[model samples]
Target chain A: MKPFTQHSGIAAALLVDNIDTDQIIPSREMKRVSKLGLGEGLFAGWRYVYDGAERAGENAEFVLNDPVFRNATILLGGANFGCGSSREHAVWALADFGIRAVIASSFGRIFRNNCARNGLLAVELAAEHVDRIAAQGAEPVDIDLEACRLTLGDGTTIDFDVPPADRDMLIRGLDYIDFALRYADDIDAFVTRDRRSRPWAHLRASES
Target chain B: MARTLFDKIWDRHVVRQLDDQSLLVYVDRVFLHERTGSVALTALEEEGRRVRNPQHVFATMDHILDTFPGRGDRTLVPGGEAFVKTMRRTANDVGIRLFDIHDGRHGITHLISAEQGITVPGLVVACPDSHTCTLGALGAIGWGIGTSDCEHVLATETLRAVKPGQLRVTFDGALGPGVTAKDMIVHLIARYTAAGARGFAMEYAGPAVEALDMDARFTLCNMAVEFSAFTGLIAPDATTLEYVRGRPYAPQGPDFEQAERNWSELRSDDDAEFDLEYRIDCSDIQPTVTWGTSPEHAVGIDGRVPDPETAGDHDAGRAMQLALDYMGLEPGQPLKTLPIDGAFIGSCTNARLSDLRAAAGILRGRRVARGVRAICTPGSQVVKQTAEAEGIDEVFLAAGFEWREPGCSLCFNAGGEGFAPEERVISSTNRNFRGRQGPRVRTHLASPAMVAAAAVSGAIADSREFAETGTNGQDAA
Candidate 1:
């Protein structure tokens, strides 16, 4: 579980908000249990043709159809980005699309966390700021996780403040599991104490 | 500053306060879905442990498995089969009950929770999936959790957490013609800038909530996640109790009568604390549709896209740009003119019987677009059976749309049966994120009826045209 902040090779930008789990890789793509390469199917319709035109045309109507943004690294999106069902597929799709960071005005908490834990950055920007980045399409909006700044093509750098906890996550590239894993010793001690104090979990553990 | 149900529930859920800034909250139930649940189960295995309270955790196969086109897991699409298999094995290994693909009780998480009374008010519920907030419609504190979070909760039955401030969105007056809770919420998301419910537990209140039926109330709470709310809820009113009556796990008979008395006391006091409050008149809302990639990038069905020239700021300019490119709409163009390639009616959000009826009424005599792939999928298995029995399925099929089985079909992208990339789809499910369906499959969520209208016209069309097809759109109101 690599943290989203560590990855810089992939930059993802999406047009829609509230991207639910059903939409990410779709239930069809989850046939295998392993976390394999789901990137090819990332934004499948948009990256491909509109109803089978082969490669997306330059004048194609959809964002994924735009030629200039063929390999966009960062995703600039509208408000309530990643809204809807809690599907890690939404995050998987982004990460698979080579989109390491998704700079949006807002994110659905569940989808955003899945991205962070899966090494996909769900960077937050003010709606106003996100609008600017979206306007700069295919021009690459640099997200400096350390500095918490979103730099535009015109050299306009917008400061983004990362929450301390999330910042720690990015800096160390630790998802919640990895973050908790850091306190494995402490957790072990607590588990030992808790087992003795309550025994419900351990008792249940023994029986099940 | 009127108190909403969310603040009331949040205050009561607080248990021991730790020295560190976290709250040691108590969880009543934990729902484990297949995708992330498998990981959580494996982690527990690595730790040599079990679910803290197996009785409190419920497992279901909703996301990964394909139940669409009907029951046989073997017949399920490849992806759906794999998801179900992974989920089934994980749940069995953990001694958790699994609602495998064919189970009559199988469906979206929220619907199952309600049907089973697992979402009784005044309890804390967490699931690995986002729409878990749909249970919040019952006044429970519900939100989505990650696999590790699920793992922690499994071992400890509690997790370190911060509480959310409450946002009370009070809509007074009755909803008008063609507007259901889905439309009202979509309109609000469009108006409130999508992030309006951020950092808050959105409580739907006032005359609007009280007037809404159980299904409508569920629709409101279901989308709270759309606006970044931890969850949303309405107080357990007579309507709530009525909906839960006789549910499998609901308090029965005398127990139920007594439970109602307790439930009635769950409302917040008039002076309850709240972080924010917004008021709207129900009459002011209209049929809403997205002209761009984001849900917030929406306007009334008749409204035009926001002109970049008129965009208020630099950020607004960017939003306009992406919306224009992704939705294939020019700035200031009327979204109503944009064509659609498909229309889907299903998902946890709007896949109920009422949604189907509404959509069916509109499609009865209409012809689906020539090349559009239109389908109507019920949210639950029960809904499918009921709609079919009522001839609603016929209405849709007659309109040239596919009347699929119970599972979530185009609602999300689960079965991989969605429109081609850049092919616009009018969906009844929540969320329309980029590549949400079939990679570049573009989605516009509306009431089932609205999607039905789009299916007929092959573009974003209003459901009003179908008011006379089956029944009056305003008659329900």
Candidate 2:
């Protein structure tokens, strides 16, 4: 994971509400077992014209395909963005496509967690603020994770909130598993007490 | 202290606090499917990490596996076999149990988890599939996670997660005829919007929920993700205990009795307060179906397509117009009588034996209308064998519907088999996202009986009209 202290880049606006993970990267495009090479498949359903599964050409109507916004590194979206599926590929696809951050009113719980783990900044801002930023078109926006603020192209700034733990993880490029391992003794104590109190809940090796 | 059920579970699972909002929570069980499991396991191996508790982890080959008769590793999605092969090899190398294609227990991750008694009350279950919330029907804390989280759980048997607030959604009164759990959940999402329960762990309560059997409860909780909830749960009752008693991995004899007593105490206290509360009258809910891409675009079966002009707010109206354009539907067009090209009854949402039996009840003496392609894929090998023994397969076959092997067939086009482009399909699956079934395909989410009714009529018809005089034939159990 790349540490994310700050980033400044062009932002594209896709203001449709409930922009689910399927639209971000359709299941059919996830044919590869690996995560690499998904950048081309990001938003495949809308970014490209399809003739029975073959990408016949780019759908120039899509915001991402617009020449002015083709290099956008930040995404401005509507409420409940990435609202379906637990596919980490959606976040990976966005990161691979050069998107460093996403600003939305709300997000799917798992998708937000995926973004945190992958160092893709998921900022929750008011819908009005997000809409205001989207109105800036392809202009560059700056995000300061350390300061918890987003600066629009017009020099106006809006405060955003990322959960404290997720913000710490992103700024430090830390793996949560490694962080969790630090409390090994606490985990072991809980397991020992839980096993005695609720033996049936713990599956034995023989059961497997 | 009158703690809610969610609070009790969260407190019990907390190994330590990671931050002001996050806790290091112990995971009791982890379930995986080939689609994302292979990637997570391979990544873990590359990191030189081993599963801390392989016995508590279970994997299956479902997401990308072919459901054709005599199917093997071959799949419709290009390069899909690699996923299955990698999952099988990785599960073996990691020493975790793998329900391969030939395994008699092979099925969708959520279904088999419950069927095998791998998800018990008060346990924390994690999976890589969004519908993992289905396990919450048994009073468990089950939520979907990304591959990185999957790897974290596999390596440490614990997860760092922010504790969610609690929401209690109570369904009062009884569900009317032709109204199933699928309708109830879809109705909730449609009325409250997809993100109604966002950032919350939801609990289903009240008389209507208590009346539902285990299968129906599973159906109700299966769509928690669609509502953007961390998970949805019901208090474990006699129905849940009875369902778990005889399952293969369930506790035995004295242990079973003890477990039952503990599970019986898993409900929220009488005075427990939730962060949010919603009370819905079940009688007001009709057999529902999605008319557009998102599940939130659902309406009663007898309702008409909503006009974008009345959709409220410019953004919502624009979204509705786009959905209408994609669906090729008119604003005031009635949902009923709209012709359909295909009908499907399967997926984790409604493919258990009970779901198949409900569809078979509707198809017993009826034939799928001409030009309508209908199919039924049982949820598991055990469900398939049981349905066959009960003659449910004959009903589907005689009705001109294809009886297929058990797997997630045509549920998201990952298996490479789906309805043609622009083909309208009435399905019992959970999602109706754009191109979810196939390129340019249109999908309407409904219950099993509703799908069967559409198959027989070759159109979107009110299932109540076809119900037998005294019964709706929609109850799973």
Q: Best candidate per DockQ, number?
A: 2
TM-score of 1: 0.80
The root-mean-square deviation over C-alpha atoms between each candidate and the true structure, in angstroms, is 5.8, 1.3
Stretches of model 1 off by over 4 angstroms after superposition: A1-31, A36-85, A89-107, A111-208, B1-4, B18-20, B67-71, B74-80, B253-258, B337-339, B365-372, B457-459, B468-477
Model 2, span B1-477: residue lDDT tens = 998888877788888887788888999999989999999999999989889899899999888987899999988888999998999999999899998999899888899999998888889999998899999999999979999999999988998888898999999999998788999999999999888997699999999899888888899999998999999999998888888888888888787888887887799999999999988999889989899988999999889999989977566677788899999999899999999999999999999877887777778889999999998999899889998999889989999998888888888885778889999999999989888898899999998989998999999987778853222223445
Which lDDT tens digits does candidate 1 get at residues B268-375? 778876788888888887777776666677777888878766766545566567657776777667878578778788888888777777777777777888988877
Cα shift from native, residue B266, model 2 (Å): 0.5
> In candidate 2, how many Å is residue B188 off?
0.5
List ranges where model 2 is wrong by over 4 Å. B468-477
Q: Give every collision pair in model 2.
A: none
